[model samples]
Target: MQDQPLDASDFELIEDTLLKYGDDHSVLNASELDGYFTALVSSPVQVDIAEWFPAIWGGQNPDWQSPDEGKQFIELSVRHINALATQLAMHAQAFKPRFEQTEHHAQPLTLAEEWCFGYLRGVAVGNWPELPTPLAAQLQAIAFCAEQDNFEPPADLDVAQHRQQIEAIEAAAHALHDHWVAQR
Candidate 1:
């Protein structure tokens, strides 16, 4: 049987725990973690958990109040990662990125920056090699979101434009996963 998927409560617990223990450098929320796992799952090569787990804490493991707490966190993380992999492989186009939405300049915008940053971090862990032109274009779509420092939205930036960019991120993720699946 397929492993049980994480529920809303599980995500709430994750969010709570992250807020309680995560530092400035650590992944601040479940959405970012989801993006991180998405990239890890879509990577051309398998990235070992040993190498990637600590990355969630920005290269240091979190100090849990109890061992059981840590166990629960690890279990949930593994389940999430597995679920993302399965979704990407079996329902590539149906995959939707876990992005947080917030208002910027009084206009609603999808905050993909954190998610994209997590994805880029995962890509770094995988030490991704040069890609073909087509795949590069897809990855570029994601990278554009991550380049927060270089991006400055104009005063007239429409919410539709932001939505379109977020949609491209989803498509890129699905395409990247499909490419790796075909390769493997």
Candidate 2:
């Protein structure tokens, strides 16, 4: 499948399967899974699939109805993971985080809460070492976006600035990846 590009249908299938079979602790959807894979690919040290795959299902394997179903999920996830690594390595400028928009206080808000949350989860699984202050600051943008309960405008900032923070997640991801690449 290396020659074949993953399409929207592949993501839809992954999201549908996760929703259908995943427990409450599973990553919420395809966007989040993409974020998770991004973090894994960008890690300074490699994380084994055996160590990280179970975390995708909330620390256990999903109760897939059939072995074929389980195999398909694995295949799709691996393909996506490889795609993320290749993109980060060779086409960083074109990288985009899969964010979603929703109505917040009757205004359209682009949110990356789920995606950032999944990324943090991957960071935890990767057991990333403490970063220097500058790099840590880049990661702070992602952490800020991941706050589910406090997704509102920061008390110190206006709506536009808050939206900008959300928008900065993609740049933050690229910076983080580049930092790790430089370290390697």
Candidate 3:
């Protein structure tokens, strides 16, 4: 599948879709954004990761067989997703509309980018029983940013590389968000 060339139409369609999913707010906050993600990802699809048994992969998902193991594994997954979303939402394409439409200096994120990130973060916070609405939303937003930048799921992703990419996006977003926040 990888060896096959990407069709132009397929690529273009995904790219267009990514453009539509950027932040609704010109200047978004983490908590609020996390809430947004939680709302989106709190559906049944997210609840049934690997058929509600993430350990199905020969215990590849952190050996989470026991109740406590499952709980911890889920929590860690959620946190990582939130981080990915945050990175996804921070790209230049996501903030382009904001920059052009408003006075903010932020960049733009495309539809596919926003969708991927939002989806990740949304899924992340959706499973957290203890996650406050605000904190969950913020984390979700962070996840959104990360996902947009090509975040892969744990079982399917390259952990070390993905983490580095997510971290870099987060650092850049933090700087940009801080600057805009200070203006208010």
Tell me the TM-score of each prediction against the true structure.
Answer: 0.88, 0.89, 0.22
> Which candidate would rank higher by lDDT, 1 or 3?
1
Rank list by TM-score? 2, 1, 3
RMSD of 1: 2.4
Residue pairs with backbone overlap in model 1: none
Candidate 3 lDDT score at position 77? 36
The residue pairs in collision within model 2 are none
lDDT scores in order:
0.83, 0.83, 0.37
For residue 30, give model 2's deviation from the true position in Å. 0.9
User: Which window of ten consecutive residues has the lowest lDDT sum in model 1?
Assistant: 149-158
**Model 3: per-residue Cα lDDT over 55-164, one tens digit each:** 22222334323676456434543553344334343442332111101111242212223333433444443443444465445455556554444322334445456446
Mark the regions of model 1 whose C-alpha exceeds 4 Å error after superposition. 103-108, 149-155
Clashes per prediction?
Answer: 0, 0, 45
Model 3 quality (TM-score): 0.22
